[model samples]
Target chain A: MLNIKDLKVSIEGKSILKGINLEVKPGEVHAIMGPNGSGKSTLSSVIAGREEYEVEDGSINFNNEDLLSLDPEERAHRGIFLSFQYPIEIPGVSVTNFIKTAINESRKAQGLDAMPASKMLKKMREKMRLLEMDQNFLSRSLNEGFSGGEKKRNEIFQMAMLEPKLAILDETDSGLDIDALRIVANGVNKLRTPENATIVITHYQRLLDYIVPDFVHVLYNGKIVKSGGKDLALELEDKGYDWVKKEADNLV
Target chain B: MEDLKEKLLSSFIAFESTLNGQAKSPIHKVRTKAIEVFEEKGFPTKRNEEWKYTNLKPILKHDYKLLSHPESEIEFKDVKRYFLHDTDTYKIVFVDGVFSSWMSRTTHDGYDICTFASAIEKYTHIVNKYFNKAASQEDSLTALNTAFAREGAFINVPDNTIVEKPIEVVFFSTNSDTEMMTMPRNLVVVGKNSQAQIIERHQSLHGNNVLTNVVTEIFAEESSHVSYYKVQNDEYTASLIDNTYVDQKEKSNCTVDTFSLGGKFTRNNLNFNLTGEHCECHLDGITIIEDDQLVDHHTRIDHKVPNCQSNELYKGIYDDKAKGVFNGMVMVHPDAQKTNAFQQNNNILLTDTASIDTKPQLEIYADDVKCSHGCTVGQLDDDALFYMRSRGIAEKEAKAMLMYAFSNDALKNVRIASLRSKLNLVFAKKLGVDLDFGL
Candidate 1:
């Protein structure tokens, strides 16, 4: 369902992702594990088409269409979703209104009419209940004065609402407590389907205990150094990044 | 044309003599001082600091004839009809700047209301104490109004009497004869522990080039509450200069809101004095100008006593080649410690040619006071615009929606429901935004 070939990206003339190649099929959960500054976020941003990163060389193909040729919102309309590391707070706009606008815009891009308010409200309530959010969260301003865990949960709630084909979670567990992590993992696990794919990017294997990735890749120095089954995440967690660095250096 | 200024000056002199001829006491003294000030200052030109951005060249170039008391009486049918609940409440009407006794109503009990001309003779003591006390001839135009103050409205509320009904005064400028200038003065007094609301509306009927210079002074006594609303919807060729001065006593509350949507050149002066501790004052304004109109609002709130609170917010939306000016000042006296004062002026320039000059001033001499003043002039946020556009709303509708949202905070602060609805209608007609969008 997704193919990336030697994707080299740079921001402000500094190359962040160098010659990285990855592939994933439907019904598969791919976990990218690396230490800080390992180009883990660069890969996700490059796929999501954030304008800040300059694609030095490479091509990204999603279902046989050039992903890099589209705008941010265009990619968003094409079912490319990236859960932000830090969600921006939009004041004076309620979360329900924001989500409705997004859904309508995406649907319009596909030549659909605006969704009815009644059905949208019902769907929103069901999703909010799934994430254990209060009724006030739906009416309050979008992400304004929201706690860190609440913002993450709201992101997952948005993901459920949009139901994108490919989902990328970047550093979603960084600021979350253990309870928040479990709840977020449960949300991600519940949304998995055979027709969609998930890419979980993290630094530790703690999240792997719940989401259980099918493929685990260790990324270091702007390139994916090794790819293995789910046991690779546990081995890296026990031996630390230096052992992996030595092993990759020997392989090179 | 050469003798027009001389003719206006003599007309004002004749008016002064007639006013003093009727009652020659404290009011005569005040009017004489105002005339002297007018003679000294004359009319302000573009050289003045306050009048620099707003030029009166058009007014000065025209040969405006003085409008005397007309022989044809002003009829009640000329005024806009309002099905108010209180039928016994009085009404004072001004036609071509002259007070008309036949066009007004009266309550049997003098405690309720009466006309200014009739009440002047009966309640001279009450009128003498507050007449011209708050707003005087500080400027040339103000002095000119004072010189021609032949007729005005004087309202007095008895101590501890709650005036449940609103006193409505209609000031109509008739230009059926020729280009005219009308000046109407008003004094409203709220007695101790009394409550009242007043609506003074200014309109021009059958007037092509009419000018209305109105001065209203409000005295809110201790523990009293006063709410005043000024609605200016005149002809395109009409101009207005309305000034309101409010004085708040201990524990009293005063709110003054001015809605300026229709006028060629509109200038308003609002001054509030918090003379007693624990008194609160609020000044809110919204001005929407189009087609090269010039709207200027100058407000000053003086915190004269300790522990007083004052809030002022004035917002303007200027489109086409229109220009807007807001000069607001919050002054804290030296002895007024622990005073809380806030002032903000924000403007949205829809077109590149549209201009705004907003100045929010804070003069603090007192220690241990909380005072803040800020002014912002900019176009809409680009990110916000993109966000709204991405929602499938067209660019024009999204712009209008954002502009309406920008003004929502200011209009929602209006406490009166009827007034809020009226103002919303005016805004909706201009911006094409439905009034029930967010409510």
Candidate 2:
């Protein structure tokens, strides 16, 4: 459902992603595991069309459409969702209102009528229930004074509500306890379908045990150096990234 | 330079003759003294520190005819939109500085909500004691208003009487073809243990050059509670200089909210004096201006006695070369121990040409006092904008939503329900959005 060929990205004249290639098909879950500063988050941001990163030479095609030419909101309307690691706090905007605006804007972009308020509220309640959130949580300001676990769960709740075609969970497992991890992973697993795809970006292999990715790729120094099945994550966790670094260094 | 002042001095005789018995009363003596003060100070120039950011030389240059009578007739159906129609209120309406008895609904049941001219004769003792007592006589504009103050609202809530209906003091200037000026003075006294709410507005019917210099003095007696709301939404040709002074006695609570939505130039000098122990005062203002508009808010709160608290919040949004100024001062006297005062002034400049100057001053002489002040001047948060945009909201809608959220903090404290809803609609219209969210 997503394709990236020779992706070269830089920020402020400093190169971050250099000549990377990745492809994901429908009905498959991909996990990109790497150490710190490995451009895992940058890749997710580039795919979601963040403006800060300058893509010097790259081509990102989502559903056979040129994604780089679209704005962030346009890409979002095309079912591209990026769950941020540090959710921003928007004071005075209730979560329900914000989500409704987002949903209506996306629908308008596609020349569709806005969803009925009753249906939206019902769907929001159903999604919040799946994430084990209180009904009052929807009335509070978006992510303002929310706990880390609550923020992560709220991200998953948004993903469920939007039903994005390609969901990139960038470091979603960070700052989450075991119980939150289980709940988030369970929520993601429940939403998986044959036509949708998921890319789980993480530094550790703990999140993969619950979500259980079909493919695991080790990203070192901006490029994916090795690709294998779910066992590769366990291998990286047990033996550490030193072997991957040495192997990448030898290949260079 | 002396043309407007000389004209005002020459017109005083005609203005004085209008007051039947009040010409020889003690209030006239105060007026005579006030005119002398105005003659001495003249119009404040830019050299004055307080008037540095604001230049009144242009507004004072106009050859404005002081309006003493209604020049044109206005049907109540034509101007009824200005009033809060949904709420029950005691309305004191004025047209061209003259009271419109047909348009006003005064009260005589237990409390006095009538015109200043009648109140001066009917409740002579109350009018003589509280009139012009709390306002500053040193300022030239205030002194100017006092010299010309004749017809306005006078509200008196007796001791221990809770006023059920809020009072609406509306001044409508219908000088369609001529440049005119009006001064409206209001005196409100809430007796001990009484409570009252008031809404004041200045509206011009046509886009003519109309200047309104208003002065309102509110005295909250011991343990009384008062809330006053000022809505200044006039045409581009209208300018207003509002001087409001409030005095709170022991255990009293008072709040004044100033909303400057539309005006060519507006200056508000709001002062609150906490005279006794355990008193609370709140001053809140929200200003939204665009296209060469200017709104300046200068507030001072004096914690004169112990165990008093004061809070001030002012927010401004300037767009397209508009200018805004906020100067807030809080003073805790030597014996005013355990005083808690907080002041915050925040502004957002939507364009490169828009500007805001904010200064928050705190002078604490007491040993034990909690006084904190915060001020910020900047554009909207880029990260917050991006966060909203990435959630599928368009860029313009996202920016408007963020601006609405930024101003919501000040709008939440609006005490009157109908006025609050009206303000919400005003804000939505300013932001160019159809906001249906519950406030």
Candidate 2 C-alpha lDDT tens digits along A1-252: 799999999999999998889999998999999999999989998988789999999899999999999999999999988999999999988999899999999999999998999999999999988999899999999999999999999999999999998899999999999999999999999999999999999999999999999999988898899999999999999999999999999999
lDDT of 2 by residue, B194-222 (tens): 99999999999988898888999999999
Chain B superposition TM-score per model? 0.92, 0.98
DockQ of 2: 0.70
Number of clashes found in candidate 1: 0
Worst 10 residues of 1 chain B by lDDT: B80-89
List runs of model 2 lying over 4 Å from the truth. B437-439
Highest-scoring model, lDDT: 2
Report the Cα lDDT for residue A36, model 1.
Answer: 94
Error of 2 at B363 (Å): 0.9
